[model samples]
Target: MNGSYNLSSGTHYGSIGTATCVTGYEIHGTANIMCDNNGYWNGSFPDCIPVDCGSAQTIENGNVSSTGATFGHTATYYCMPGFQLVGPNLLTCNASSEWEPYEPNCQGMYPYAIRK
Candidate 1:
């Protein structure tokens, strides 16, 4: 388990147990298990999948790109020609399935002037 498990009745026979995922992960499969006469759990463990932050948003006169949006990933922002980035250029995917440091904005530096 990538996280922790809680057992009721102190692992005694006929006790119940549940699996919980830590931050940045979601549980998949059966989350509950029953204790057997051998004082062990009777069900398979669940999979803890990483949280997804979905796709990066696009801004006018700018482009947003990233290799992936899962936890611990980064999104890079680049302004188009004649525009300027108004904030941080990078946003990282956090444990809560959101992008941190906020998304930047693209401002019109010069309508016709080339950006260097």
Candidate 2:
């Protein structure tokens, strides 16, 4: 089966129609779309790709940080104590298809001993 379809940004739609199997060419839209033979969408089905965090921000000054991620994917940051993260440790794609400011994790005070 086929019908008029309108896909908005950051949205993915797929259908097998009335057919027993869905072909790659059956689905159509301005945005990326895919249909499996079983009539199912794949991982992150309609995930928005992420952009790289090329710039670096300074925190407490223990380790350097950079942003790097793709849509439908998450990025995590780790640093030593006393040195915190000034940016988001986790970012998710919003309905607008944009990522929120990186969450910053400020490092806690260092301990006297290496092992607690």
Candidate 3:
């Protein structure tokens, strides 16, 4: 597999191979297969699909831009005119099939007026 998948056992006949997706990915097919007597693998080939974390959670008084929710996808946080980003402004789908650094929140602008 092009993705990072681990195969258990060898490819010889009568051997059983187990396919497991790496962190941040999900399996889309049979996770186990047996080697047939004809030197062919039995069962459908497993595929590792990128994990989807879904669109960024709605941020109060802010908007998020995402390039899909699949692994390796990125989300950028933006606050409304009067709000400020309270945490990280960017997030990426990481291993363990979750977003790293958690989601950020928007906070109201600084309470006090600024003096030059």
Top TM-score model: 1
**What's the distance in Å from true for residue 12, model 1?**
2.0
By TM-score, rank the candidates, best first: 1, 3, 2
Which parts of model 3 have CA positions greater than 4 angstroms off?
4-9, 110-116
Which residue pairs overlap in candidate 3's backbone? none
| TM-scores of all candidate predictions against the true structure | 0.83, 0.31, 0.80
The 0-to-1 C-alpha lDDT of every candidate, in the order given, reads 0.87, 0.42, 0.80
Q: In model 3, where is the ten-residue run with the lowest total lDDT?
A: 1-10
Q: Considering TM-score, which of the candidate structures 1 and 2 is the better prediction for this target?
A: 1
lDDT of 1 by residue, 65-85 (tens): 897989888999999987899
lDDT score, candidate 1: 0.87
Q: What is the model-wide C-alpha lDDT for candidate 3? A: 0.80
What ranges in model 1 sit over 4 Å off?
Answer: 111-116
Backbone clash pairs in model 1 (N, Cα, C under 3 Å; residues 3+ apart or in different chains), count: 0
